[model samples]
Target: MLWRAGLTAALVCAIGLLPWLAHTDPALTVLKARSAERTPAPETLRAIRDQLGLGDGPLHLLAQWLGGLLHGDAGRSWVSDTEVLPAVAQALGASLLLMAGAVVVAVLTATAVCARTLRLGARRRLGARGPGGTGSAVLAALPEFLVASVLASVIGVQLEWLPALGWYGPQWMILPALALGLPAGAVLGRMLDDLLPAAFAEPWALAAAARGVPPKSVARQALRRCVPGLLPNLGLFVVGLTGGSVAVEQIFDIPGLGRLTLRASLAQDLPVLQSGTLALVALAALVALLARLGVRRLIGPALRDGALHSLHRPTPPAPRVVSLVYLLLLAAVIAFGLPRDPLALDTTARLQTPSAAHPFGTDALGRDVLARIAHGALTTLGTALAVSAAALLTGVLLGLLPRLSGPLVDTVNAVPPMLAALLVTGIAGSGPWTPALAVAVVAWSPLATHTASLLRQERATLHLTATRALGAGPWYLLRHELLPAVLPPVVRHALLRLPGIALSLAALGFLGLGAQPPSPEWGLLLAENQPYVERAPWAVLAPAAALALLGALAVTAAGGARLPRRRRTPTPPPAKPGPAQPPATPGQPHPARPVALTTPTDTA
Candidate 1:
């Protein structure tokens, strides 16, 4: 709780300092946003500065803003010159609705998937393969932005099924909700699927089945047991939805907090930006608190009784065929894209359909689509790899020191990658490195959490105790036991997260917070060609296809990295039946038996 409060305070302070840190004049930026003219008269500049209190300095202005916030005041926006609280409140309400709808959709989708798997008796089969298997991987890999673009183009524009542009009614929320929910649902379903087998394999579940309990009843019981394990991640998903919806809101033109925050940051509207950040941070903290309480209520007894030792099991590697297929597709994309010049433009062939000269069709600028995607692979994929690798290394190291990393992880994890990108852009200004930097800030938390949890389990093993008793030094134990035991799983976690990191980068690029125009980045390609969707759909499909392929490859490859499972403890021989004690009187307690306890060995 202290950490959450501190994180919220820190973020609010950081947002307040953005104008100062960026070394730009907030007044000038606001003036430019207000008018088309780049330059304004001295009188106008002075008037604007005076009105917005720019001369008060960032500290004094921030202090004044904070003072006002204590009494239900958020000040007024520099851009609109209206009460920031009301505008922020409206945006927050919309975002809350969107997030609530997305969460409901995600929960239902996951429940349906898990129910199907359990009904088909595929729990063990799917669990062995990990998560939702290949299908979920494909679904999870689809970025929200890409999904939104396709849905808006096909369902909104082509089929005329729903209004995708505005948020007038509940009907307007469906597409954006689905776009956010489906991918999150895939992820949640996979996680639940991975956990179901364990629940079903429990002794209680086995006894119920042996007693001829209905399959449906047993399945319900199993789900109940597994849900507690998923609660933390569920909270994460909700918090993530708040930050991840920025692009979706923009695509749908919803005046949600994310879109509002993005606009305010760009325009240097400190009041609006600060208030939005505070709302998001508060939402995250509340979610975290509720999730913690829920998990404790559901699973606390089992943990206290030592009935549950660990929530995670070792994930098996992907099938050879899947890995091979992913590699082949990746190689094919590279082979086709590397040879051509992405920058070579021809006005004569602009917006041409896919042909012998341009396999992926030309964009508005007549540049080779295939060539740009291939080159973009370097920028997008390369950065993702670098960020993932860095996160892996950093997470493993920090995870070894759980005490030091715990608070940091909790605080950083509260801020989603999208929110982090907004903050980074605000501080440093948007550039090629902004996406990578922003992603790196939030990417380490998951891996660190995984490693820290695994480390705790590993330390509790008898083997580790014996090794320490034998005078094995910390470094030796870390190298031979801890690192060996921890690295593979942590690396696998990082690999599984690779696609998401890449997607975040792409989303940022799509939002114009990444590489500028003519860079051929995949996200930028989608954003650049969105307006010409009807003219040439191929331009948009090409990059979207490339991103999807990359996601599939990462998921498949990560699935192929297996971990050595811990050896199970051997069940002790049944003790000779002891003579039953006489029943005690109503007020007297029964005598306790002397029970032997044994430490479990760890032989991974």
Candidate 2:
């Protein structure tokens, strides 16, 4: 516990030191902004540093800042020359409120949807158009902006049910909450639907039922058992909400930490950026610690047993086919939308609102937004595909290896993928390929950990032991046994990561660490036109809509709508165990029952 606390403190300190590593001097930047000058002189920089109790050495300044942080002093904002701690405190209050509402909405909605899906499945009545299957698919595919747009159009523009923008009252948070929560809920609901049957079939659950526990109580017990599997994904969902809310907060004009970070990043406000990043790092650390504790508490027995499996349900072919068809249709749209000159500049016609001649209108530089979006779609798709493939390959190879250590695996899994990607990009420098490479590297940790866990579980099976005793080589066993069992789940896991990769890609682009100027990537378009939102809202809205569509399609491709296939247990070897085997029992727990978040269940 002491070591863990010390490591966390070290991590926090490392994050706080990021500003000092920047090419631009934080003190110089502050002096220039404060003086309202294009460039501050060396003497001015030195004087400002002296006034602020800063020094030339980065480590010295970092140590000073850390000391002040212990005393609750977060210093002053570089851009506004105002107190940083107070500003961050105010922003954090709004963000925490937003996060709480979003989390509540996510949990309740997921619970209801999961219950409905499980009930419908138990009845064996879900169809092509059923709410459980089809609705989950659709909702999972739609990105927050697309969902927000549809809601804004219907609930705001058409019915005037709520304000489309701004943070006025508690009521104003509902829309943003829904925007963040709905996707999370959709993902969580699908996970529950797939895992609940197996949970219900666990020995403990069945025993509880046979002992006169009420059906509702039994079901509640089953849910608690299933929750440990959901814990890591739940952590990811929370972090994704906090990170992805940057776009939503901007669209709705919310003054949360997300919005604050966005403004700071764009304006290069070093002090604000430093404080905001520290807050985010702290949030990530807190959530991670909570998730670990939750998992340990809920699944102590299962963890000790080292059990894991994938969901079991009949895999439907229809959704897979439908998703492919949608991808093809999207490709056609991209082909049709490709412009003769996406980069052609026309200053006279700059910042035009949407019109028939210019479907997505023009940007501040007069580049065709429609063309840019189309081209950017291709880039986004290509990058996501590449990253996903790389991540899968790396994860599968690492997972299949026999000698990986548990402590190393745990350390890897502890780092959040987004944070890792950002750090990688920071080191590798900005380029079109940087984000994809960084994301792929970050993505490997979870995938590898999941694969390794599942592989370890598979290796412990009696049949695998028999094969080993019979002198089956590693390659032969891997090829004939493990690969076949593991491939399907790995594929599904990789696909499910597509939507997240898309978001990360866009985020990198927004930060100017991805596709550069004149490239017209969705995120770059957003960064370029955000300041002109009031004058030409269409400029930002168009690319945002495209990003939403792309993310939705990726989600669909991830098998969000697909049903799970049942696992076929191999015929038992001749009984040779110490204890006599009991008669076949219903709801008997499989050795591989308790699953890791990204691990695939065995499906023969």
Candidate 3:
């Protein structure tokens, strides 16, 4: 555990060096930012380098930074020239307070939603058709930024229920908490909905119920069983709280670490950025440690022996209702949802809020928000689908081919996806294809690794060997046996990749590397509307809501929620082949063969 924590710390430090890779001379960028009027001369660059000890190698720099960190010195901000630790200290309390509130809100929301879901249809699978499932899918789809904007607009501006912006009374925290917590709650609820049913179906649970145990008591036992699996998500939730609230902080004008980090990135304040990265990573590491301890305490011996895989796989699904819902959503967005000319400007109505004339209102440039979102849906959803398809196909091809060795695939999987995406985007240059290509390049690694593993396992199966012995060729085996066995899981994996691809596209777009202006991509909309959020919050909220919808549709279509891991027993070995015997006629007696019963002494 200590070594794991140390590894995480090392990873965080390594990540901090990525910016330096992007900018070969980060000192130049910093120096240039300090004085924009004059280009940083060679002399000025040398002076800056000497001041920061920039001539030192990467290891030396890392060591120096680590030493400073241990001494409670995070150096000073490049832009503000204030001590990084002090500045972060000022913001840390606010972020931690906000996160605590968010955690509580998320827990309550998840519990209520999941309980209701379980009560409605405990036996039936949770699907998009169910209200709880649909609502969760929708909520889970929304990114923090969009949720924050909508909350600000509806709760704060229109209804006057809460303050639109600022960190003031407890009421201010409520809206931000809701924005941060609701989506997280939805994710947790969805996971619970998937997990609880399996727990209820366990043999011990069934036996308890059969013995006239109270329903509530039975439920408590089942839920207790779920604790081990669910605990990890809480750690993830904490990590999410540390990093995913940047948009929330920005929208609400809260003095949180997220807001500070965003501001620092924009200003190119290296010290603050590095410090913020380390702080978030440290928080994540601490949460991971706590989660590990909590699991050991809560789960105990069960944690060690719990089955890790399921042998009784579900039957292949037919076209589900969720598929139709996705189609209908796309059709509706294209037909009734879109306004006239999404990109066209109307200077007269610039910066307008939601009104009868324009349902989603107008942007700073007078472009209809509804129109842009409706059109952007096609681009965002389409790109996600394309990238997912490309990745899945690539993974399948590579996995199926015997030429690609396990070590090579493992090496590819070892490369961090984000790092790969950055490298691809850097080489390719920013364009619409950047996000899709970057995602495809990185996403294939996982699918290929999983597919290869599954194929190897399948190859070892007696049935497949028997088929091959019966004169089946490689193509026949691949097409008939391997395809049927591998297709279901592979398809599920592809579907799961869709939402991630969309999120990646949005992230890249936020960094100005995805779909450019006039494209109406959701990420582009978020970036373009940041400055106008005060006046026309609808512009930001509309597209953000659309992104969430698209994400939800993708997830729902992919089977709504992840299924819990089931306990597996080792498969018994296949029977050995016996000597051939002459076949007897139907309904006729066959010749009896002499059989010898042998003991250990008889063999001797």
Best by TM-score: 1
State in Å the error of residue 393, model 2.
4.5
- Residues 274-323, candidate 1: write the lDDT tens digits: 88877776776677678667856655554443344333445566677877
Residue 22, candidate 1: C-alpha displacement in angstroms: 0.5
CA lDDT of each prediction against the hidden true structure: 0.75, 0.64, 0.65
Residue 429, model 1: lDDT of: 82
lDDT of 1: 0.75
Better of 1 and 2 by TM-score: 1
Question: What is candidate 1's CA lDDT for residue 140?
Answer: 77
Model 3 is weakest, by summed lDDT over 10 consecutive residues, at: 594-603
Once model 2 is optimally superposed onto the true structure by TM-score, how far is the C-alpha of residue 206 displaced, in angstroms?
Answer: 8.5
What candidate 3 gets wrong by more than 4 Å, as runs, is 1-19, 31-47, 55-60, 120-132, 157-164, 168-171, 305-322, 335-342, 348-362, 368-371, 386-504, 526-545, 560-604
> How does each model score on TM-score?
0.84, 0.72, 0.69
